[model samples]
Target: MPDTLRLVTFNIAHGRGLSLYQKFSSPERIRKNLRAIGELMVKVDADIVAMQEVDEDSHWNWNINLLKEIQAVAGYEYAELGVNNRRTGKRPLAYGNAILSRHRLEHWHTQSFGEATLGEKGFLYAEIDYKGQVVPLLNAHLDFRSRKRRVEQVESIMDYIIENAHRGPDERPLAPIICGDFNSRSKPQADAVNHLFQHILKHREYHLYPRDKRTFPAHLPSKTIDFVFLPEPYRMTRCEVLPGFLSDHKPVLLEFEL
Candidate 1:
């Protein structure tokens, strides 16, 4: 049987929902939000889930590892967390991206972008064995403030992908898929979103899925910032924006077959 995988990319906003400040101050609110987020994850039921803005041992979030919490309820056997932002204060803070899967995740690696005033942002790279084939995956979260910063980050990502594409067959990534909260709204006026899209197409030969879906502001989404890109030989059978307020950004669910 051909392998079909259900993938989801979500920015859980540290599981704080809309009450960001309050959720950090009040433990009860954090607990409530986490419970709701776990329920949402189970409902999604993705085979491999990539998350951005996830918390890892942060004091504000009651020092709870948000990815582990979600993995418990989502029934994923393997999970990897990369802390991209770190603070060395009395009450330390760390934020990053994560990947959770039912299959073993190997070759775990992470890349951080150039320094930005807001904070450090990066992507998680790993490989998984699916139906005896090695599949490469990248989960990324780009800068949300400036388009120039996002363009730089995207260029870094593209360089990495292009470099790996030329490696020998024994070392190259097989049928790679990149997905995440790009934070660059889709527009036609030569913006960061289009720049990143064209860069991937030109070098990596990857195509975006569900061209019309909007995936931000989970309550009333109007921006198409999140995306999933895959190369040929991998067919996206279904792609849709899942409706929920589990986080500030709506979760994007993609089903692909190989």
Candidate 2:
């Protein structure tokens, strides 16, 4: 194993390209768009990829398993989908956050903010085994519309971390490397990103990367809603926003030393 780990967190807009609505895209077109994203992943050569808004058997995306499509080209050894929303029948739907890793993923868990099967946001937690090292990772997507809800969601995630910290299957579970589309800005004093970072600071120093790099609205980004919160023992070597039009939100990459 190398001294550093490279990871990328991206919201692929359900593999619908830059379109505002996924319903307008044909199944084949969506597949092609997703393959292009996979190509980007190959170029980035990240050890682990965390994704939000990925689909699996979703009607809007033509019932395509978006993770498999990406893995087909990206070629990760292990892939797991954490479905936060799932609806069946005429308008079937299933989509959420996912992780693709070159290492093994174990003890996977998923949670949703609400019981509603559509448009619900949540997170995925997993313990990844890289050689003999065990790393705890959380891939999250908070409420995009409400500040209060985003804060509440952050609280829930913190609680989850506290509850699992000691009882985890791993003998030595490192502090989580939390990454994803937080949906809340890092400014104005009360945003979810700052809120989560402050909570983590109680125990040890945590670093939030790509400090001022805007990621949303890829073409003309106004604010950054994507980030990686890495705790102590893992030092950030480099963090940057990658250029791409694969999704409405550009991907953020983090290279860190464990």
Candidate 3:
């Protein structure tokens, strides 16, 4: 109902922080980390939060459903979980993306990029009812290992958007918002980031948040991999990188007007 919408994109790193290589951590540690992250979310009070590397009933985080905990702590009424990677056995492990929203999330959909070099990754698409406006929202996590794979993933996402969100050339439909950890480094020679940026520019009237801050390695961040892209009719009022090491990547918060 308000004039502006605040959204955040975070990679929780399964609540492991800097110790990402470890198989698992003590229950106490994980709980503490989750609590801290929840408190941060409450403080930020974002209308929607797109998360990456979230665990669902996984042993790595002591079988805790991180998404539920986050939703509860952040006081979000709606949520959608997209499991991109799952291991089936006695103790099944599932990992993927999640979107926690204060608004109603309708017609939610998920798609996987079908076997990349590193692992399976995908995006979560949904339409949020924001003050009577239907806003198409996308939360995505691309392949982290291969640049070529990431480019393909970006192309796939662009195609999905065109098929579902595009309203034609004449109609000025509400431009969709895409947010996530693109995993595209900030270096000038980072072809993946350039390719993805150019691809969006070519396909749609898109605008990206200025790369003025770093998000990864949260404690002493140095890379601007996470991003928020807004197309025409949806302009950002403000953008900030929240300071925290709750996850390996700091949350990027964007306030936009529709």
Candidate 4:
């Protein structure tokens, strides 16, 4: 039986604005960027795509219903958009995380992970009903200002899963397959993703449990920050970084078997 899943996570940087290296704000340039992102996702062929920084506001065309547009380009029917930047003033912007799936969804919830209101972050928790079983997939984007804040967000996420995974009202939580843009850029944060692996193989309960890890500089990824954390039951088949595209950060894909 083909009982495997391909999941992808990328902080598409939505309408945040151009990089410091980019000075001129050209529509063609932005469209090119979006097109670039869409093309990459099409090739990845992930069963589920979790994207951050997608625009849902109307201030700029770059922010115009980006999740939907991208989905249309990728040809995925099922999708979920969790709006983190709620409407505040004439600028009713709502760019958060998005989860796209080809499988039938059993349950869905939009979760916030920011400890404070610095730069709000969210996660798209979804249950994929494949072959008569439920598998939970989480797509998240953590804060980037401080390491402490990011670590707190990670802790909250882990706690939420372990405590409330199987307690959703309308859906059953099979297992959490977490993947996203975790802006932790240090040794402490990098090792935190492998908590159970470290415990089992390295014989330690935890290492680098409270540190920030960075996953930027995809072409020359010096520090591993982005991740697709597979728990005990889930097995990782492949992991790779797709860098230097539309988004400031690189896109990551994880192939695994359920």
Candidate 5:
């Protein structure tokens, strides 16, 4: 059954538009949340866009390149940027996590993950084709005040994508789609699941938040921690949590059936 794609995951908190603050130091609230993140990606037409806290200032010279101005206000003609903080003083402090595509990006990769409690956490891999089939996208950002450091950075990003699994492209049949901003969607019962943290329990595999609800207060999102995952045989028709207001998480959409 392969043919259905509509994905989105956001953490535009560093477009600094209207100031979600990540040290842009405020220029009239980064000119109103960088124009409310280009009207929140054109009201979420997202066919693929997993972003999180982006910035690129080698040293605060500021030329305003908030990920090409939110992909030219959500026009997304295919993009990729996964720097995960690269500061070099006089003008080279880059931020990270961004993977966009209206389908056509054929290869990409980036690493840098950790039990990292709060700084550089990245993973933005891509290899899309969309209109003609072929997929595998991941853009993540986890580590919000430790849960065993988000279980060793989600088990070192699923053991580095299951031990490289052929480095993607060439035959592309993985069809994975793991989105972002998962500050651990609530699981503090302690119990005995930390068997060094394996992850495969959120409804036994993957299919998150809709009944699990909540996506971090855009005004009142109790707490869902933003996510979207699908692998093996692809199949998820609706996964929502998008009311939106600029940040503090509120963007997740998936359709996938590919």
Candidate 6:
């Protein structure tokens, strides 16, 4: 029998729940929002979850570890945070992408696109052992404003994968499973998501999920800016854009067997 897994990628807007910004919300409000997000995570029941714009020990969010709060409620045994933005002073702020999993995560690493103290973007890479099979996974958040920068960030991601995710061909059988807030459309040959998808196809065939699902502005979505990319061997069993106003962006859930 093959093992099956569920995964979700969501940009949580730092747990503000449709608020304009974190600064406008109080610490208690942020915590309340996060608890609701945790409840959603439980309802989804994903084996591995990718999250963007997660905060930690930031004055704006009342020095709360957002991931921990979610994990506390959802009860995930393993979690890792890739802090892409870090600044310390009278008013400290730190946040980035993160992953929570039911399986053990190993050899995890984080890479940022730039050195900006805030609004920086990046990805987290890790190799997970599932039922004795080694699967490489990445959780990323790319630039949302500039198309050129998003493409550049994709290039960096590809380069990193080529350099780090290799062992002997016989030992490494599966390509990495990537999920994130790409901030670009899946159409148009020139788009960042397609660019990365096309580039990886040079080596092995891959599939992009929720191709027609619009995930942004959860209450009234009109664009698809989040996705999950998996190699051909992993057969997708189910895919759905979850409904809710958990954040500005909706969560995409994908179920697969390997």
Candidate that would win on TM-score: 6
Determine which window of 10 residues in candidate 6 has minimal summed lDDT: 165-174
For each candidate in the order shown, give its overall lDDT on alpha carbons. Answer: 0.78, 0.90, 0.80, 0.65, 0.66, 0.89
lDDT of 6 by residue, 102-199 (tens): 88886799999999998899999988778667778899999989999999999999999888874635865457999999999899678799999999
- In model 2, pairs of residues that clash are none
Model 1: residue 164 alpha-carbon error in angstroms: 3.4
Q: Please give the lDDT score for candidate 1.
A: 0.78
Candidates ranked, most accurate by lDDT first: 2, 6, 3, 1, 5, 4
**Per-residue alpha-carbon lDDT of candidate 4 for residues 1-258, written as tens digits (9 for 90 to 100):** 547887777787663334543224455665667666666778878788888877676454534677777777788888888877665565455668888888888788887764332258878788887777677778878777766666666677766766667543555444577777776543462433443233323321222211233346644456655676666466666776665646567677777777
Return the lDDT, model 4, position 152. Answer: 66
RMSD to true structure for each model, in Å: 2.3, 1.8, 2.5, 5.0, 16.9, 1.3
Compared with the true structure, what per-residue lDDT tens digits does model 2 show for residues 128-186? 88766778899999988888989999999999988786333555445798999999888
- Candidate 5 lowest-lDDT run of ten: 189-198
Q: After superposition, how far is residue 105 of candidate 5 from its true place, in Å?
A: 22
Count of steric clashes across candidates, in order:
0, 0, 0, 9, 12, 0
Query: What are the models' TM-scores?
Result: 0.90, 0.96, 0.91, 0.79, 0.31, 0.96
Pairs of residues at least 3 apart in sequence or in different chains that clash in candidate 4? 184-212, 184-213, 184-214, 185-212, 185-213, 185-214, 186-213, 214-225, 215-225
Answer with 3 or 5, whichever has the higher lDDT.
Answer: 3
Candidate 4 TM-score, true structure as reference: 0.79
User: Model 5: residues >4 Å from true position, as ranges?
Assistant: 1-8, 11-17, 20-50, 53-81, 84-87, 98-108, 111-123, 126-136, 139-172, 178-232, 247-250, 255-258
Which ranges in model 3 have alpha carbons more than 4 Å from their true place?
115-118, 166-174, 186-190
Candidate 1: give its CA RMSD in angstroms: 2.3
Model 4 worst lDDT run, 10 consecutive residues: 202-211
